[model samples]
Target: MAEWDIRKLQILRTLRDRGTVTATAEALHMTPSAVSQQLTNLSRQLGVELLQAHGRRVRLTDAARLVLRHAEAVFEQLERADAELAAHARGDAGEVRVGAFSTAVSALVVPAVTTLRNTHPAITVRVREAEAQEAYELLQAGEVDLALSLAAHAPTAADPRFTRVPLLADPLDVALPQDHPLASAEEPRLADLAAEPWIYGSSGPWSDITRAACEAAGFRPHQAHAAAGWTAILAMVEAGMGVALVPRMAAVPRDGVVMRELRADRPARHVVAAVRTGAGEGGAVGRVLEALRRAAGAPAHEPPLPGPARPPGCPVGG
Candidate 1:
């Protein structure tokens, strides 16, 4: 007869995932020595070697791989047990933690929280602002019940660990100094800005969006200025330093900048709500997801936002 500690298996799984004891310790909030100690204990419990030294790192042994495959089934059944309980629960009366990016907090999560207050008044929601990568990490560590993430940085659709729900397209619009020539066009083509100096983040998703859009338009951008904050980027555009692409949800009226839709192929960032696979079936998580969908579908003004709109007059910061 043998007994297995789920905690030790978790450590082993994390080591398999992260490739180093240090990284596994960091992810699990344990010391590297503690991680090694736990794995050594796991080896004794299972009566098999679980890891082999490989260069500076360790590699999972064949026995460890076999154990992991079975452990995954054990985890699935445990989640199903919780799901069965949740399916029969009557009230949604517990705190739910959410992690989201800054802009999504304002445009999506805020409105959803407001509605949850009125509709499911017993539900208390806690919100944390984090970009995509950090948010997913928090999700994996079980710190948040849900994460609002972007398509560019989310896990692949096939990833078995989390469930992805499409929330918004959040089309990209060109922010121009009000006096720019193409600001007057019905729909400006991205190609027309090939020669203009660009303003974007020094790194991260915004820079990726700007670069991908421009390169797709058949030219590379000349980044003359770098700013990560939307306010700073818009301010630079207002001061006429350079043009920048902004998400529709993040574009706000600032008096000297006009936001316009691009002509043919418009670039956009996709937003999604992610939760651990079976956890999405719980009453609180399910209710919150419905609220997010409603918030995302609401009109583009004020709280909650709309998709791309072709304005009669130039919209945004005019």
Candidate 2:
């Protein structure tokens, strides 16, 4: 079996197009003797005569013409491959796997996916709902390209493995029964609710936020009910079970629940997107991050909140 070198094949193709060894050498930045050596080597490797003297110059043989025809298709395919790779690198086409928490899926991930579909139709975003720590674990294990996390739960900037992109600081509002006394207050104080029973997530970053906020207000929250999902937590508050601190992004207007802004202790959960240090530089990951920033700026039904400051060198779509 004979082996073919692409460089040698390219030389033959150039010679065929150039018509003479001197012209081919000049076009390829090589000496005429070097061009002749490559042609001779190619002919010997394929066990065929590729060129012959045509009066004052050389001409490609029929065998060489046949090889050049096939080589033309190979060159075209290589060019197409380069174009596709460039498109992927630019985020014009490719897939990004994202892991997010449930609330983030509702508030940020879903909207980002919709925006990507409308703008970068060739980019596919796959999202999975996972808790903050779990999302980070997925990113570390290469199971996801990007992960949405609460800032308190994310790794420090010093961690070499990941780059954090701050998205928003979702302010915590007090969810109350429509008829509750605090519901009518222009701005409720967290200290006033010290005696009230609290509805909170069973465990996780939200639970930690609730505990810290209440402690800051001079009382430990009396956890009367525990629910993992925001819908359930808000439902409990709606039924007059207890008051709950709900992040602005997670607040969905329900029949009996009214969200009141906290005046004194306006605790907020900072949301951030994390990717492998260099992974978010461009391509699908970069596009997804941009969409997330846009989504974070526009919450479903709530008043628009100020977006987090963009990190240095971070690219946010216009």
Candidate 1 residues 160-181, lDDT tens each? Answer: 5677776767878899999999
TM-scores of the models, in the given order? 0.88, 0.65
Candidate 2 Cα outliers beyond 4 Å, as residue runs: 1-91, 298-318
Clashing pairs in model 2, backbone N/Cα/C closer than 3 A = none
Q: lDDT of candidate 2?
A: 0.77
Best by TM-score: 1
lDDT, candidates in the order shown: 0.80, 0.77
Q: Candidate 2's residue-wise lDDT over 1-318, tens digit each?
A: 766878998788767656788878876789999999998999999899999988988889999988777776676465445445656676478888899987789888999999989999988998888877788878865688888977666667444456677777777888999899988987689998999999987776667778888887889999999987778988898899999988777788999999888856767777788876556655666778888988988333232122234332212110
